[model samples]
Target: MTAWLSVIGIGEDGLDGLSSAARTLLGQAELIIGGERHLAMVPDDGRERLCWPRPLKAAIPEILARRGRRVAVLATGDPMCYGVGARLSRVVSADEMTIIPALSAFSLAAARMAWSLPDIETVTLHGRPAEMIIPCLYPGARILALTADGGTPGTVARILCEQGYPDSRMSVVEQMGGPAERRIDGIARDWPDGRAAELNTLAVECIAAPGTVAHPRLPGLPDDVFLHDGQLTKREVRAATLALLAPLPAQRLWDVGAGAGSIAIEWLRSHPNNKAVAIERAPERCALIARNAAALGAPLLEVVEGSAPQALAGLGAPDAVFIGGGIGAEGLVDTCWRALPPGGRLVANVVTVEGEKTVFECHQRLGGSLTRIAVCRGEAVGPYTGWKPLMPVTQWAAVKP
Candidate 1:
């Protein structure tokens, strides 16, 4: 198919920065589409122009309607890098469009800060939760974030101070590659006010205060860190369970009967692309799961408050499923097993004898491995440290063939 859509990555420099081929396409285009700021950059050229509507997805149909027409789209930097072009590509194939590239915000910010792009983490806070960056906040880490507006810098600064990285350096580079370009720099504790422009990128150098709590991005987070009513999975068993589940990038997990949402939260923490849904029957536990997810830097964790096997309906199929609670619940395991695609994984942990019996039967029928997990911690026993054993856990793990 002949390409009719030309997606150009324009910078703050606007027309001056556009390549000759990009300029030619814009001149030939019968319709131009872009945000208000981007649309204002192009002078009245007698071509039809459309500013993006609220909820950008609403414009998809209009773009599709003009699929075969000469339509030009203006986007910031690289359209594939958290830009409208990426979203459009999902509905429009590569053969139907031409993409012209420009320097991304990450590249421009990295150049200004003298920071290496590969070494630092890059995230977009535009139209996303500020807490989404929490996972990237660690001592000695570097991050470049694309802001939604002027207030995002202060919001991120407050989060840094609250997370014990008060001394972290914050630099907001505004209007990059343009005449109005300027930058504001300070520590998170004393972030300068009213300096960030609406269009800007924030750079941070994480520096933790002494005695700050370190939350590593590992599966076995300390059980004490989570708020639970003794229904939480022990740290050791959680590690073993996660090892069996084997989370891969971009894979989705369904944590049935999630208690404290430990497995689901840790799965999200393992990789940014990883997603999870915590299905719990209790409303109070569902609320606790949300709290734990936010605190653990996995705010994207979806909490489904209802009994599983019924609540599982309408949810997108998962790459892996973990049943931590309700192991003995009738039809729960069968429903989850049926939901799995070929090569999909299922791992269930149980501590009760009845639950273990259910797991044993499933192991026999499903042809998977069953293992016992046990852990003991030292505790004070009459002024002497003695081993206090935790309840042993029986785990069943299988992959749908």
Candidate 2:
């Protein structure tokens, strides 16, 4: 007997903000689940109450157990907007739950600031690194950040100042849609008044410093941004490899023999939903991979330290697999190929004759496109400018049937 799950969205005004039907629903609820703050607002209806368990996920079993009963979950604003509803939907069937949404905090904040929600970038610093906002800090950018607590404003100020966007405007709009609503405004560089409410949102208007270099959102960030030990894929090859890899939303990649993790980093940068795992053998290279991933705004990238194919054990299936190093490792191609489901992509790049032979054999067996990439840049050749060619790379790319 599966219980019906009703997710009711509430705002800072609590029960007053809900409709008559919503209030009646709460009054009739047999079991109520919500955060401590939201649960406090209920009119002492004497319903069985449960605070969301630590980790939230651990409590899913109990929640599921209450199925087919008058079970109701309370959330703030739109439950679907960076709220528990999104997480629950992934585990629960759509028919099992009914989501009753209220105006989201993002929308309320936008109304307060008179900023169009669609025109501004929306992010949540709630349980996220402030550094993750790196990709959004271009001059003249508008962002609305859902903050976790008071410290988020200071963290935002420091990150913006570091990136030369010190003069950026920050409005800490707290307790929106309630009698305690307040707005604190300041610039990022001089964010001196750190006073903030426990429940607040950070709205930003970026103003970069004169000399600040804004990193663009694209594959192949500048090679100098990474900490590598001469083992990284060059900017040219990395860009080309990423193009061939073709990252899509919700896709995962496995960067086999990930040297400096440039491929994985760029793949992640392509889209927020994109995921990747960097498999590297060298201890130093693994450390470098972590550094580049964090600095470049893809901290979620998984770095597996050990050589393949032994290191590749128990890896999540990937939508794409790239072999940038250790192309000569035995059983590497076969293992990667067997791991990929149909429609998955595989690309390998090699500079040596032996490595080229391995790719060729795979191409023959697997049926993909093979090409030799010969890249050259102008160099001063004995007082005369001429094309200086770097070592040509043979690339084999294929998609699984």
Candidate 3:
């Protein structure tokens, strides 16, 4: 039988916040494991203390391999709530562990601001990048972000400002649930100086202009919203293409040749749980995709700055796939089709004749639906009206056999 591991959640209040049961567990722990802050909480009376290595994932297995040890792992707040508990739980069986959770910083911050947690989106940048929070932002969306450090709030503020949401209200909750608990409220436009804390969580209230483009809930958002280099599929056509791809929740998507990331962004938008790895060769286009994703609340689009076929390796399999660009007469379609699992959908869109022919040939061999989409818009050429024909898009969609 594997020895039990006790994962305990502690707050800045230290032993004061600990329950009698938790304190007893700490006292009896033969091996106490925690971050520096957490280790300081327990009375240092000869219990073997271990600090986690730089990459926590690399350290977990070695620590767990030590058998017959009464190990106590300390985390901040609730162990399962954006804490280390969830990651540890994945590696260890439930039968081999007990979790003692305390008040989470999220709860404390929300309570301090009198905000209900269910109504708000919680993002943690503690050990992650600030960019991860971009996808969760929506007009009127309330956010509780566990900032990486003092620098994160500024980075978040800058990103929000750049995304045309400069007026969004933010409250910095520092040392939450502790004696030095402080809250600083201000608009993102005029972020207060010296208001940031190394250990703080931010409460953001997104405020967007009326009639601003509402966040799309589906993959393949209208193309007009993106600033593309004439290398993007238009809105209606993109939507149709995405439908053919058939994205599923929590599925990974390999968006090869993700020009402007229209297809990839839309894939992620389809389901908050869905993820996409967009491979685009152009640096400018990659940057554009990041900006568009950040602005539209789909910032989780993992942009890979490389061309497809060569870049496909080391990228894991996808449940669905979209090839929006770089589909030539040879190799591209075959590679993507081979990567799909049974029941997986592959949709490729092409505007150029050369690319269209390639798509047609792939459709012929793969046995899927093929269609050409022509989109035109009304423009006032003279006085009354004129119809302008945008270039047609040829699409091929196939399900893996």
Candidate 4:
């Protein structure tokens, strides 16, 4: 098919910033589709114009309907970098569309700050939660964030302070590539209410305050980081469970009977693209799971408040499954086992004798490895420190052939 759709990337400089090819396509287009701000850049020409509808995906059919005709869709910066082009490409084939390039916000922000693009972590807060920035808040890290609106900078600053990086340097570069380009700088702890421009990119130079505790994106997070009511996986056991589960990029995990959602959250923290769903029976624990997910920068973690086996219905098949509780629940393990595709992993940890028997039976039938993990911590006994043993855990891990 001839490329009838032209997805052009435009910067804040508007028409002046567009390439000759992008401009010619826009001039020849019969229908122009974009946000009101982007549409305003072009004077009312003879072409039919469309402002993006509520829930942007609603306009997909309209774009598809005019498939053979000249259609130009305007987007900010590089359309592939967290823009509408990526979403539209899923439905519109590359052969039918020509994607034009422009300087992305990240590129502009890095230039203004004199920072190396490859060294910084770039994320989008546009239509996403602020907590998504939490996982990227380590000391000496550089981040470039595309803000949702004017209020995002303050929210980012608040999160920085709460996460023990109060002394971090913050810079908001407003209206990049435009004549009104401006930069505002401040420390995260003392970030003022100087409302940033709507079209702005936030840059952060993460500097830890004195005595700030570092929480690296590793499997073994301290148990206290999660809010739990005794129905929690201890730190060491949780780490062991994650090690067996083996998180990878863009892989999804099903955390069955997620108590305080530690395992699922840790799985998400391991990689930005990793996804997890926490299934819990209690309503209060479900709410706590959400809190933990948001606090730990895994706001994308889905919390299903119901018992397993039935709740697992309609959920997308996972790359890995971790059964932390409900080992005695009928058909729960079987349901999870059957859902795995070839090479999928399943790990179950149980502390009780009845649960251990079930795991043992599963190992005998499934032909996988079994592991027993016992942890002991030192505690004060009068003037002496003695090792106190916690409940031992029996784990069964299998890879579907």
lDDT of 3 at 120: 87
Candidate 1 residue lDDT tens string, 1-401: 89999999999999999999999999999999999989999998688998999988898899899978999999999999999889989999999999998899999999999999999988888987777788888889999999999999999998898889999999999999999999998999998766478999999999999988878887898998788978899998999899989999999999999989999999998988899999999999999999989877888999999987889998888999999988777798999989889989999998899999999999999989999988899999998999999999998999999
Candidate 3 ranges with C-alpha deviation above 4 Å: 1-3, 209-214, 220-225, 269-274, 282-287, 290-302
Model 2: how far residue 261 lies from native, Å: 1.1
Which residue pairs clash within candidate 4?
none
Model 2 CA lDDT for position 248: 92
- Candidate 4 segments whose C-alpha is farther than 4 A from its true place: none
lDDT of each: 0.92, 0.88, 0.82, 0.92
- Per-residue alpha-carbon lDDT of model 4 for 1-401, expressed as tens digits? 99999999999889999999999999999999999989999999677999999999899988888989999999999999999899999999999999998999999999999999998888888888988898888889999999999899999999999888999999999999999999999999999976799888999999998877788788889888899998788999888888888898999999999999999999999988898999999999999999999989999999998999999999988999999999899999999999998899999999999999999999999878999999999999999999999899898999999
Per-candidate TM-score against the hidden true structure: 0.97, 0.95, 0.89, 0.96
Candidate 3: Cα lDDT at 274: 80
Give the per-residue lDDT digits (tens) of candidate 2, residues 134-237.
Answer: 77778889999998898899988988887788999999999999999999998888897555888999899999788788788777677888888887788888
How far in Å is the alpha carbon of 306 misplaced in model 4? 1.2
**Which candidate has the highest lDDT of all?**
4
Which parts of model 2 are misplaced by more than 4 Å?
A: 1-3, 193-195, 380-384
> Which residue pairs in candidate 1 collide?
none
Model 3 steric clash pairs = 219-266, 220-266, 223-235
